[model samples]
Target: MSKETLTIEVSWPASLAVPEGSTIDIQLWAGNDKAGYSMIDGDFSTPATASPVTLEIPYDSQDLQSHDGTTTWDHFHTSPRLVHGGFIKNIAYAEKISVAQTKGAAWKMALR
Candidate 1:
């Protein structure tokens, strides 16, 4: 499989509540499931806006798969081939957000 650098820019809604100088963990999941192939995580000055992270990803036919009658795919495998057809798609997720503790302030998170 041919290899290339994949750059992804991640950001959050401006209306969302985010603490300044908090650490954010971003994960890149490929294919049809939650098994992530690559990840980039660090502490940034602003949690709402993050710099683009790059992943050395496989491309071309070896980067793709087809679910014919007998073809099988497993998430635990380390192969970069995640797409099930002729196209490539991926999912980006933000996780493990660390909030800075403030003196005399109460922290509350609303779940949707």
Candidate 2:
């Protein structure tokens, strides 16, 4: 299950008004076929510019250990607000990931 092939994009739109030194934390979680979920990867960074910060994460299905037993879908949790002075805005929704997409191919997750 070590499918080292998930791409995660963390970005802040230039149009959004964010404080100068604000930072955001993103946590990525994926679901197991069984009734559970696992945290795949996460990052905390400051978007000092308009370009997106890209992180290459491994799905590693073998690592599934039911971090959250209450959910059956793939989802991510973000920091409540930016570090400096503004609320972080999200542009994407959590979607259910299929077994094939979770174990076979690379998945692209963008958090804006």
Candidate 3:
């Protein structure tokens, strides 16, 4: 089996209220499987006011399984002393491969 790296980007809504100096916990699950889990704990710091925030999370492709060329991913967020809940709807993960061909070469390699 080969390993691939995937980066998950999440855009946070500006309307969500977040306390200053508080940390936001982010969790990623592959489908409904509990074994396919990845977490970014306390990695996000809430600003003084709500604003659009983007988070870039990296994961191994082996950690997630795709069906029909698409994989279902779920994200959750919470703060200290707050109940953990889903932050957004289901996210679809598709495998994207880019290949570059060089001169004098009859073939190219797929890069993911």
Candidate 4:
């Protein structure tokens, strides 16, 4: 089953903090369709003058796979907290994704 095009903006109070030299490992979604996404395209970098800066990622993709059968990554990042991801673009598609909180963390799966 598909979910409604979802947009989630999760915020933490200034009191809540991440250690220095740490990046908020998060998944960014790009469209509205509950079709669990796999390959996504985006970028993250250490912000200049960084001080607990929240990175706002605006994304949009259509091909999202679900977890009914589980998925594997072709390549992965060194950071254990950083999950594996991938993607492709062309033709046309939808726009909203939902964030599923998993493993004491959050995985933003594009329901497209």
Q: What local distance difference test score does each model get?
A: 0.28, 0.48, 0.32, 0.30
Q: For candidate 2, give the lDDT of residue 92.
A: 45
* TM-scores for every candidate against the unseen true structure: 0.29, 0.49, 0.34, 0.30
What is candidate 4's CA lDDT for residue 83?
20
Per-residue CA lDDT of candidate 3, range 1-112, in tens? Answer: 3343323232334544444543333444444323333333224322222233333444444444445536543422221221124342222232222211111222111111
Error of 4 at 77 (Å): 20
Model 4 agreement with the true structure over 7-102: per-residue lDDT tens digits = 222333344333444433444432234442354455543321233333444432222333443442221111112122221211112323234322
Better of 1 and 2 by lDDT: 2
How large is the C-alpha RMSD of every model relative to the true structure? Answer: 16.7, 5.4, 12.6, 13.3
Backbone clashes in model 3: 0
TM-score of 3: 0.34
- Model 4: worst 10 consecutive residues (lDDT sum): 75-84
**lDDT (10s digit) by residue, model 1, range 1-112:** 4333332224333444444443333232223244434222222211322333222322332332333423222221121211223332222322222112211232222111
Comparison by lDDT, 1 against 3, better one: 3
Model 3: per-residue Cα lDDT at residue 87: 44
Q: What would the C-alpha RMSD of candidate 2 be, to one decimal place? A: 5.4
Candidate 1, number of clashes: 0
How much RMSD separates candidate 1 from the native structure?
Answer: 16.7
